[model samples]
Target: MSQDQSDKGTSLSLEQILAQAEQDQSVETDYQSGFVAVIGRPNVGKSTIMNEMLGQKLSITSHKPQTTRHRIHGIHTTAEHQIVYVDTPGMHLGGKKSINDYMNRTANSAFADVDVILFVVEAGRWTKEDNAVAKKLQNTEQPILLIVNKVDKFANKEELFPFIEEIAKEVEFTALVPISAYKKINLPAVEQEILKFLPKQNAIFPEDYVTDRSTRFLAAEIIREKLMRTLGDEVPYGATVEIEQFMFDEDEGRWIIHALILVERPGQKQIVIGKGGQVIKKIGTQARKDLNNLLDARVHLELWVKVKENWSDDARALASLGYNDNYSS
Candidate 1:
């Protein structure tokens, strides 16, 4: 057996791996490829915008603020160009936990070494968090594309002009485009703006690869998303998911996954499990549906809840749960 099977954890033979590598290296000379960092404050539709651009959901999103805890890359490739969209955790000011620090550091680091920066903000809603993000972008050298998302909420397009002008004063952007990522309104314009700054180079990742993260990492996120969506405000923020076992069962012809949900306190664990285990069951059902879609195969998912006190605050525990700076697949 090879030392590395596959980054996505699919059991591919050496020949298949070599064939994919050959395809990845055969990009045309005129191909335009570069990184575009999607950044903003929490729940400002940054992840939604990237998903709209890529026509797929690579980042786990929820209505809750600070739902995205890590930086994820969603890759889009075409005959003409390849755009790697870096979806980061929403930059915020508060929260002194270790995970919060990790997320903020990850978002800050993404600003460097990127071809363009997509500074996303809600259409009619602007806050101090948005101002903080703008201040950080002022020092960046890359072309900042100010993306005003959720314009569909406004009935009158003319109302957006004043709002756009207000943001213009705060962010020194190369271009400004208003879009509704949720409604899929004018997402192409956002892509067009990104292409204007994308460099003429070869593809960074394999065309077949949609993301830099492993299937294991994605599985954990999917499970985490369900927890975020289903649980209450307090418990979800205190919770994190860890994949203990992720492997394919050849005899059964399905993927088997075991996940451990860590919480800060014993009461939180009980809350996650719910009365008669109903809550956990519902979360599992919802997560399994998404997991099947993500893996494109049948999945047998097992979920368990445990109390790991203050894991989010503990630096070592945070790293063990995949909150580290080095997010190597």
Candidate 2:
């Protein structure tokens, strides 16, 4: 999806919604705020949904499954509510490796702590993975908003009625809506449902903040997203982008970010670097443009590809790659 996908939803600001709410002075509306977990199986457009909601790309996304490794928080604050959206790794049916266990742990941990969960799934496609997530939801009484994403991909609009009816029988959902996260369809409806469930309380984060992640983290994620889109399925498993150094120049008024792209082996590194370093160069250029827009300042991005043998399987290696347990907490 384009970086401007968020713009599609921002035609009406949250404040405008709050202004309408404030009109009724007799109602005495207490401020609402809470955490919401966006959970689903891999490649279900969870990140795409949240990024569009915030009108900024805080999370990295690609066609590849398991693209989101950390439980990232995108904060949307207003006089009415502050919704801290948690984008977790897609829960999968695997545990042979430490990374798989780490992803499952990161995703499942959010359910217990959040006020609402967006159980996302693709339109007209229900796999065993979706069934696994629904089966787990049966144990919890938390308010779940069943999000059937990618409705635009369907050949006919009528295809959604049966899809909605079939999936509704699988679980008890608080609300159900079919949306195209990529096309910015029905996002406001989802946002309204989310606000309806949030508890009445003061805001947890500052009003200006859109995400809990730093600019450096966003840089690395942008680079990884470009690599995923560029390399396609040829990209190796367990590849990650880590920012080595992030600093701003006081004299030049620009941000300089040094990133290390970690791959499983030398052969995979060769694929990422490409002949004459063309692939990595392309990734850096694309990432730099997003950084410029995200920070609203000049950016100089330095990228390096390195081999880390089986880093995903080793706990210490995962920590070194910035997958530490504290990152999400």
RMSD of each: 4.2, 6.6
Please, what are the lDDT tens digits per residue for candidate 2 over residues 117-179? 999999889998898898889877789999989888877888688877877788889998789
Superposed model 2: Cα runs more than 4 Å off: 1-29, 155-158
Pairs with backbone N, CA or C atoms under 3 Å apart (clashes), candidate 2: none
* Model 2 whole-model lDDT (C-alpha atoms): 0.81
